[model samples]
Target: MADINEPVDVLIIGGGASGAAVAWSLAETKMRIVCLEQGDWIKNEDFPSTGRDWEARQFGDFAISPNRRKLAADYPINEDDSPIKVANFNGVGGGTILYAGHFPRFHPSDFRVKTLDGVADDWPIDYATLEPFFELNDKMTGVAALEGDPAYPPKPAVMPPLPLGRSGEVIGEAMNKLGWHWWPSDAAINTQEYEGRAPCINLGHCGSGCAQGAKATTDGTYWPEAIRARVEVRHRCRVRRIETNEDDMATGAFYVDPDGVERFQPAEIVIVACNGIGTPRLLLNSASERFPDGLCNSSGMLGKNLMFHPYSQVRGHVDEKLEGYMGPRIGTWSMQFYETDPERDFKRGYCYQFSRGYGPVATAVNGMADGIIPWGAGHHDAFGRMFDHSLGMLAICEDLPEEINRVTIDPDLCDSDGIPAPKITYRLSENSKRMLEHSVARGKEILQAAGARDITSKTIFPAAGWHLMGTARMGTDPKTSVVNEWGRSHDVRNLFIVDGSVFVTSGGVNPTSTIQAIALYVADQIKNRIYELFD
Candidate 1:
């Protein structure tokens, strides 16, 4: 491989959303930054959408879950104890390569879940502190939406919102009739060709990787600027552990290069940007004699408090042909129930994402499997009814952190590199169940209002662990948290975390935007305190 013994001023692991953003932000300081990505860079041509069998390809190579995709660079996750399956990517762009690009910001109230609802612990930092960074990230990523969303505070202008396609228009009309809060969604996809990227062509399979290069995958957005700024991004480099010095401070990382050669890259400072699960996995695997439990896990919360948004989905089939497969998959959503309500039985709330349903093959298969369409004589008729008439709503339920729900090392399972895989032990809390029940009922009502002849809802989507968070929470108390407000490790002075693992609470919406904003904020924090960071 390349020069493994090179000294770097800053070493970042995982070139995903947060890693790329942090690299770009720190690149402004002209620091020697290097990022190690477990997977290779995903070229736009690698997307399967250009072929006729793209729909079937999703079941194999483009599958969201690493276990299903089984790419050489992916690691195995032991999800036997969890109801929701783990879904993530291992490429240079990370999950952004497969995310739907829904860029909704976390509500202000999300930071104070304990102070307001007496549930999870409150974050050390508030929403106001992150607002500026959010705006900066929004501009950098080309958010496509409007201001004046009642659900959120005032913000900068965005590109014109995605068109409310036939499905969205119908659902919006229903919500308006019902007097519920609804708005066009904020998306990371470019609408007017910002930052040398082409506008979205309404690619149908955004979740399977945006082949058009319109969606703001980090490979297209941040990494380009970071490399231009002289940041070295090493792909297919799987970091197994962080090597600490005699003082128990991070000094370097040990990883395996693409050719299965072990290498060491020394650094003055180390930033772990691997997402929620991957971050903790690396830390736990880096156990040393000075810190036997795990590096930076002096609080004994290294893999505790695992949180994934409990998600549910409902699909409706109407009589009209809506061309549901022609546009973006999850463009428009409603936050009417995003905030807390005294009348609701649950403590927190959930958001509803209204969008066109899956492709014809997926819809038909799901319909036939669920017995919604009979197999004998009624198959053709049922398939015909659902082919172009399917619309769906996803309910992202807020997940409260509990010590019992956690990510631990699987003694029996390991990745290709022989590192202990992450074992998730999670179950939905009562509040989450109640919130999902309410959401499903409301979703059915909205669908019925849209003239849907048949409707179906599932309490939990089997493979909906996209938003992993809170494995290593942030707080001011060193005894209760792993990192400080600025993502600096309490136990290791030179170590920092800039990923979803530092989340205090899981919000009711997508976590990618918040993850990036926090990364940028942490990068600024490190930049301002570079000389005195470890003091």
Candidate 2:
């Protein structure tokens, strides 16, 4: 608990990518800033370098509480119809700490729906508006990958592209035979020593924190500058609510410290960057007499438009061992069919992340379950045989906003503090369904073209990758949005939501880059607007 003599200029919740970026952006503004994270800070060294072996803390640091209501998503709500694996990490940097570090920009078609095919909301801003900031974020984050990518936008590569492995190259050449556009996947990693971090060593086990500090997890990038700028980072602190005045202007936030001590920290402005799923739930839980239906849910849309990128996968086992698991978690992407084409019964596109590399523990368990023997002589032989040859390519589908998709407080559930937990209710939209069907077929085609002997495919889960977005969407129309294009809450003057919740539409590309761009844009707006308000 911070003893603030003066109200912090901004109080940010969740120390992940969005929160970290905003905190760094606000640095040196002479404004007091503080970020509260639910999980303790774990460094790159603490992250698992190899298999599940020697990773007790990484696998065991479950945020799941003794109580049922405030449950973190460790257990999948249902067994069947799961997307790959349910993933959730609560710490500074969120999934960015655990992400594959691929950094492909959303295509120009991503921002405009009516102009492209007429479905989703036109981004209040477009690629042109965001391109410069995207470049800035790529450079600041020490991203690896050369530009000249014809499938996407035009920009000088922030850094050189990562070298793809034999598996990736084989797949790339096959996909090219089909006349589809493909490129060396751009990544938020160092390919050749940028800043203080080393280049990626091609060890594919990136989902668990990079031991070499080559990946651009916030801990390796934004956090360093944030510390240099003198920003305060409070870990193991879970915020309960935003305390506001009669005018609905946020004055502070209430939080529980690591030792279960309750405290309040004052703030001139409260920025909620707890990602898409967590952000809305926080708002819905911030119940007060003034806000009976969540803090900024006057339109009754706090947790609406919930989305999970309905993803699918294509597995491959070439005749020759590709040694896929020995490379970085990811190395490249393919967006040949990204634009929405109604002629194909879909209104959006999908991206292919060709690196689905896994380590020994994941491989042994999953392979054995998939019918490779797990015990005795057969098990040992099968495990060793499949270890070096397994490779997979995943299809990341774009989901459109539907009224039925949502996140709400579970009336029956509560956290450690007796507060209700977030109950996510979601189903694939028709557009998402169409997108998935198309992606699955195309992914299978790519696998066969690459001469894969045995291939398998998987879909994206709402919980996996934690790329959830659009629950607290932004738009120009007040009738359908919670915030302005700049991410200022439509109803609350001094309260703003800066996470993935503000997206009117979610793209196939990862949201971290967009979130960073929005944070930078909002920081600028706050600076200019405050000056205008005072003058």
Candidate 3:
């Protein structure tokens, strides 16, 4: 057993985007804060610079999937031949360090889904309650967007949008002719300068690691401010379990330090921000005599109702003469059908998009020309044809919540640490199936409108489930949800979660914005009532 470390006022597990945001939000308080991260701090020099080299960092020597064979659905089942992406950081910032950097907020209807659309469960709190937090998060994260972009709602972006190249312009013009709503995208990347970070240099490898320091990775944007305000981030520490007393208040947690020392870190408050996959696993693993079914699981919904934003995109070849890999990753989106229109069979809607960034390997993968076959000599010729002229369009569809789709620790699969890993069993609902079909159909229409001679679209989603969410969802009802509106676990008063895991619904938009907003809101909750929670 590890020795017991001196108890702090608060102990946080997983220093990713969720944990880091919470720490930054609470930095001004007078509490001794210590964050335990399982991954080490990696600098820009530590990452691969080339597109093909993405395989190294995306699936590095340290990357480990809970599933011995496959991680949930983000990637394919056989990863040996594919790019290694057991990828998620355990460091100061987590996956934000290597994300595509898109920052789209959830529509207002995303919050009260059950009430409005009569579909999945409603969030414990409504969109109005989270609106301020979203705005606060946008400014805090230094998002680049336009104030009056007709595409999305009219909110003032913190920074100017990085311009789209000829690719987006041509498509945007064509979209206009077809009466589609399109505009420059909102991104966590810097357009010029804000709060000490420089503007983006257009390196185009935002997914691997932004060496120019323009992309707003959590470590780059939040951790520095947090540390300066006295938040202590303990790197390479793996939290094993969270302990609570009979009163249902969290006491502390156990972990293994990088030095191989076993230690118990006690705290009055505990926040679990270990992303979607890690959070539920920790809660289920933290079983005790007091709460054998898992902490905060009185409703038996802690590890159930899993949600994954399974994405499917249409890859096409535009015949126009333009530069593809010349600018930032994911520059713009079309919001023509982002709202609930009965014309669309699904209760929710998907965002159609046109983005103009390319990595060498990513560009090579989908660069087949119009008249070319996809294999052998023909593949090489087609690959060369669209190498520079190619741009991509994708649609992010919403996956409705389902109780049967779950992430449970695979009894047979254990990592080197002897800890049981997560085994995800998921099947889409009829609603999501129709949504994918509709989104793909719209994508094909847009491609044809853009005058692409040929279109290669994928309406089927196989492994894009990396955006796992709602497994340990927050709600007003204890019987149906795991966390409260404030993100507190219903069964354990001292335990709180602030990540995608606590989401009640998977919004069509990328989750980073709401994830950070929730992190800030939960951090304030911890700060205002430390005494009530601890004593």
Give the top-scoring candidate (TM-score).
1
Which order, best to worst by lDDT? 1, 3, 2
Question: Which predicted model would earn the best lDDT?
Answer: 1
Q: Model 1: runs farther than 4 Å from truth? A: 1-4
What overall lDDT goes with each candidate model?
A: 0.90, 0.73, 0.75
- Cα TM-score of candidate 1: 0.98
| RMSD (Cα, Å) of model 3 | 3.6
| lDDT (tens digit, per residue) of candidate 3 on 265-360 | 999789899887788788888888988887778898876777776566775667666665656768888777767787767787878657763544
lDDT tens digits, residues 327-421, model 2? 67677788787776657887778888887456666667667656654576687877766666777777778778876778787767665555566
Q: What TM-score, computed on C-alpha atoms, does each candidate reach? A: 0.98, 0.92, 0.92
Candidate 1 residue lDDT tens string, 114-169: 89988888899999999999999998898999778888888876688887888888
lDDT of the structure predicted as candidate 2: 0.73
